[model samples]
Target: MKESFNKNDYGFWNSPFQAKDLASKSISFTDLFIDNGVVYWGESRPDEKGRNVIVSMHPDGSIQDETPPEFSVGTMVHGYGGGAFLVKENQLYFANSKDGMVYHKNLNTKEINPVTFPFEGRFADFSLDSKRKFLYCLRKNDSTQNQFPPTEIVRINLVTKETEVLFTGSDFYSNPSVSPDGKKLCWLQWNHPNMPWDNNELFVADISSENIITNSKKILNSSVGACYQPIWSPKNELFVTFDGNNYWNIYKIVNDSFEIILEKKSDFGRPMWISGTRTFSFLQEDILIVTFCDNGMWKTGKIYLKNNGFVEINNNLSTIYNIAADNNQFVMFAGNSLLALAVVSSNIKEPFKFKILRKSLDDSFPSNYISEPKEIEFTARDNKSVYAFYYPPFNPEYLKDENNLPPLIVKIHGGPTANVDCLMNPKIQYYTSRGFAYLEVNYRGSTGFGRSYREELKGKWGIKDVEDCLDAVKYLIQKNLVNKDKVILAGSSSGGYTLLSTLVKNNKFLCASCTYGIADLIAMTEHIHKFEAYYDQSLIGGSILTDKELYFNRSPINSANEIKTPIIFFHGDKDPVVNVKQTEKIATALKENNIYHEVYIFSGEGHGFKKAESIVKVLDKELKFFQKYLSN
Candidate 1:
């Protein structure tokens, strides 16, 4: 029963892909931690108001009782939080997002109590000391008056409810790890001018007789490029992942000098957007397992320290997001083209046979409708080659005429700094299954290629991104691969900005649909949070004070009067990233200019849409609008 070639034709929205499917589909796992024999993870469930629920998995692959329905274990570290929950034995320590307080719960007694005093401080990246009855963590004080948020390391007396500052004087701090004997502490720090991924240092200090850190020294200097994730081996040797050579590789410190342990031209680490992240861990004293992104796909492998040999882990997963390991096994949240995101555990020796503990995909979804993307590379502006995942309309039941090209949707991913991975994203397939060709472009600034490629958009954000996106659409049309007249542009967050900017500047697309998107570059600086206060300076080349005209000229809203095509804007009323006012202003401009437009504001949603009903309504509206405008 092979699909299509022997069957009838089916088109976009003609199959089982539904708008409700997007509402229920949740982000798999943000972070994972393993303790004793259980694995704990934070899940972003939109059905639950996008609450980050903490779930535990047993060794036998059984689902344990999740965190109390009232408690969603998440941290507000750096605005985008990871390392939210940590578990030691039957004890659970987590930062509650609602209150910004760290709470401890006894798994046996089912009792939860706050350990830190209530304040505006957010605590995360928990490091437990089994022998000292204390827990160490990174804390960020969100001060209202101060321009820069202050970060410090603090230790909490679990029993006494006392908090003591261990270290301070850093603009940002993360990964505060304590040695097994609880005698030494090590962590990562960086300043305001540079983000963690750009430059950082590792520090280590010995514990004193009075239970205070004494005589700390910088083990990894910032001049040596970005270094982070310092972990003391069982033999007390320090190992870290650094991008000293433009490639984030594993290095072990020997006599205060780095000794390359696992050499590869791939990223063994990721951008430090949050407090805690891990790419590898010691599977045993002599063996370590790690995951790295070579191009855009993720793969896992184990390094044998004894022989300095590397062996790839044989698995069906295309992406290994988070990994945690013990002496005998490794657990991770991984995904492939066929399977939705799932939490799976594998034995250290085999590393192939996996047992699924939990998954995001349900039985109701149609696997046949999922569109498998084709890797595409097209020459763009400045003679630079751009990359994208081009997915044509796919349905097992549908066949189409070769000459009757399908409509196209050029999707711009958010995080103008982020890149898309090779995985089965149902949201992307939603359009492809309905007779729409989809393209997820990797512009110049997107990561995963190399440091040089990522830095290409440093001061060319709006220009390069807009040029490359339009180039992608034009590339497909020239080859007669798509319907030139029905091509549309869409994206969220920064992606939305790129889409709208393209629509306004080139007047090439039929219409544009953006969600919580940025329009006014100058206004973005006023609305963004502390984590990204000077972000525009890096992307736009100068502060608002120095380049007022440049910001105004690049803003898409300034060209709203030039827009003759219909546009629809979706914004969260509570969004703080790019404030709700930015989108509202564009909507106002569109209406005043007599342009066909629609605006839907979700009340409780924040920077990103979070509720199931909200996701459903916005998506349905966007699809209907797409259909209405494309019909013309």
Candidate 2:
């Protein structure tokens, strides 16, 4: 008789109605729009205005609310800076980075108008080309202007409010699409030593009719892989989704060659970059539905092209987030582990019709204190295979007995080629409910398996993600489920540079933590940020003045006097991506090599950790620094 889920039985363990009250008791579906005959989504309501207001559901069903603007006191920075509606002809157009302006409602006179651009940036993809009267937009520049440059691809002129700069990116620009006679303009670029699923570039241009940008082309660059979402097929052809031979398939561009149309092993990009959405949804005239990433969930299928086949239509959707379609219906933003909205109808025996619009919390936590992860698969030291999630410590209020077995940690996910899924992250359930047993590790340069396992971490980033995170901590202490002297190891920026290069080149991490990570890969290729300033020429290859000893032998503060574990860190004194002097030069080389380390810093935060008492004081100071050195 042990059953107790607390924090008001279920609401406050880092609330937001805990993934919409676990997606309304697990039926799931939310925020996936298409207006009028109804479909509009965004939900997560338990009050204090963290998320909610914006709901609709018709198509002979009937349901409409749209209740935003309430929880005042800086309402979570104005509902996390709202705006992203765009429903043409019925007029909606949105992008109110909390009144930075670009509004225009009407849905039949619900009335609202705002538009007055001068660019304070962050309004991605809007198009009204209406035969070039112009209104094209796609701005991002998250300016703090340390000498201006972060991301851009502008265009605005709803009849001369004028603003141009068709392309100006040192890295990052996404899904611009446009071209059903808009005179061509595709997008999607990546730089930063790489991460857009590890490599990206699709780009296309030639517009001018006074919208400018008359010639530009890079149409698909690959030096071995990574290309991303760049759609444009309604008979204009020019689709894309690369990771060529390592698996993320779907390519088109006929006559000029580049053909594969849907190969698979999973992942179709999207772990970041939302807004200006579109995951292959052409709908009719020979159908094509697309959305991929299989094992780490999120799936959607249906690409017939007269029988080239692939009919998956939804395989237990898990936090889809967006996908819209026409030719008779299809609107998802799905959910199963909470996050909602689903509707499907192309008559393939219709039945999917959900509408949970945000549940925000009710079951009061206690599926044994929430810890359900298991995807595991190991192999790596170049033998390859690697993929992980693990998690294990079922917390009956943090109890453990039958011969104790918990202390583990590991983690490492910061685009060391990202891939940690099964969303609902209470910061990884506040450390397996407190007994602790995590893992995460999607090593081998992670990115949903394909493209030769993301080029096996090219020239091996800090030696293949620190030898596949020490062979997943020696396959979890040889399956004893962790306890080989309480192993630890965490990560942040580049998984905090592979947790200080695996505790200064392994002795089996008995301690290590990081955030705003990276400790000098030649001073992060001379001051990071310029979209990864040529990411050490593709993961540490040379040019720290031509590979200064492979950037000081793959920096961990140049082997911090060969560490010896105990490291903990966390930064953010305005961290513009891994720089708080890379954790104060590894806390001054763990205090001139006498070793034992710990550092904090936050103030005004940046590079991750946005308020809410700095994410509950950085997860309660990394759970009291892993219970002061793994509990003993």
Candidate 3:
């Protein structure tokens, strides 16, 4: 019998959505907490109203009903106001997004009560100083002005209903970890013009009996690079992971001095900012089990603090989002073939048992049929090393001619700073299975490599990222893995900007496609979300008025005359990040220039393609466009 693959298997299957269209699905891990001998994890489900819901899952692989508490409505979905649930004894305390208030829920009584605090801000984490009866939280001030200072740390007395500001600044603050003894508080902070990966400071403060912050000292600030994801050792000694000197390494504070624990060129931290959660699991003994992503694959390893060595435990998992450990056992949310819990002995020896919680894909697409991506490193124009995942063309039904290598689609990930990992991305598979080789580029400014490499595209966003894509294409052609004449460039958001810039800068690409991409830097800077309003300051430089020529030089819309490749553009009418007007202006220019181009706009979608129908349509249109232009 022939194996069958269902392309339209759309529903919330794995985390909340099916694996085939996971790329477009709005899924995130939330409410990871230990409760009643089981670990509970909450996830956001897709809904028309964009209501943020949390799904509770047990460590033994049991999922509870999708809980959409009354507070989820009208909350920001993209990294905004969703509360992190914390269960203490029989009661649960979590922040309510609806009113920007913190609430407590009784698991035993099923009763919910609002904690008396009048504040209009998003609350992230809460650390209870049990001895002093104080709750420390990282709160983002929701003052609606044209601009304001960054987020701050606050402390609240649960009994008195009194709130006190612990720390305030222009620097963004997050991940407040109170020491095991509740004597010292540790947190991470990063300033403007630099994201967390660019530069950050680790601070430790003495917690007074009155819940006041005292003797706050910068424990670890990156002199050469940035420090992030500070995790305190069980003994209350400061342990932090930082990319100092262009390499991510683990360091411990001993006698107020830094001691290198584990050093590697690979990344222990993810590309994005770290949530207030544990990355490393402390076992029964002194075994430090941590998950790290190298190249693109994620591995769970055990680090011996005494000998300063790490041994890989599970090498098959693509990404381990979270890890939890108890006395004699350990559990982790391991990703790859499935999102499941890996139960193992505290020693981490012998066979581990995996309880599958979520399976993204069906069994129809077997391992042999799936395309395996190979890591490729090439030199860019500045001799900088660029990393990319090259997925070779593979289709059981398709027969290929000897001379006809598969068409290539070069994918530029958004954030330009975000590095594409080896996740089981069906978006890439959708093209690869149809005989298109896909290359996802982690160009300069992409995190995971280190600070120096990430800052390589600081003032050269359009130029450097474009060059990296071109260089990757050249490398593939030289390796004979892809057809040089049939190479197309594709990206969304920042990647979309890179795609457009590549089309204008070079004529090598036969076609270019972008979704909600920026065409004008000036327009983007003028009208952008508050989270990244000053993004251009770090990306391209000052305002268009201050650096007029630089803005024009970086914007593909200004250099559209140089673009000879046929372009396809997709934008959402509701996209506030990269406004649809950017695409409209470019489409108008394309029409005036008589450049063969097409633009598609989704009515209510935002920066990303959200709706299932919209996602399928975009994929279909993109594939058809490439086939029409490149294949012929």
Cα-based TM-score, every candidate? 0.94, 0.31, 0.86
**Which regions of candidate 2 fall more than 4 Å away from where they truly are?**
1-86, 89-124, 129-368, 371-394, 397-405, 410-484, 490-493, 505-530, 535-543, 546-550, 556-632
Best by lDDT: 1
The lDDT values for all models are 0.80, 0.63, 0.68
In candidate 1, what are the lDDT values of residues 294-357, reduced to their tens digit? Answer: 7777888989998879998778777777788876778888888777788888878578778777
In the order shown, the candidates' Cα RMSDs to the true structure are 2.7, 22.3, 4.9
Task: Give one digit per residue, the lDDT tens place, for model 3 in 115-186.
Answer: 547776667666766567667777767664325434778887777877778788645776787887888998
How many angstroms is residue 551 displaced in model 2 relative to the true structure, after the best TM-score fit? 1.7
Clashing pairs for predicted structure model 3, backbone only? none
Count backbone clashes in candidate 2. Answer: 22
For residue 88, what is the lDDT in candidate 2? 51
Q: For each of the candidates, give the backbone clash count.
A: 6, 22, 0
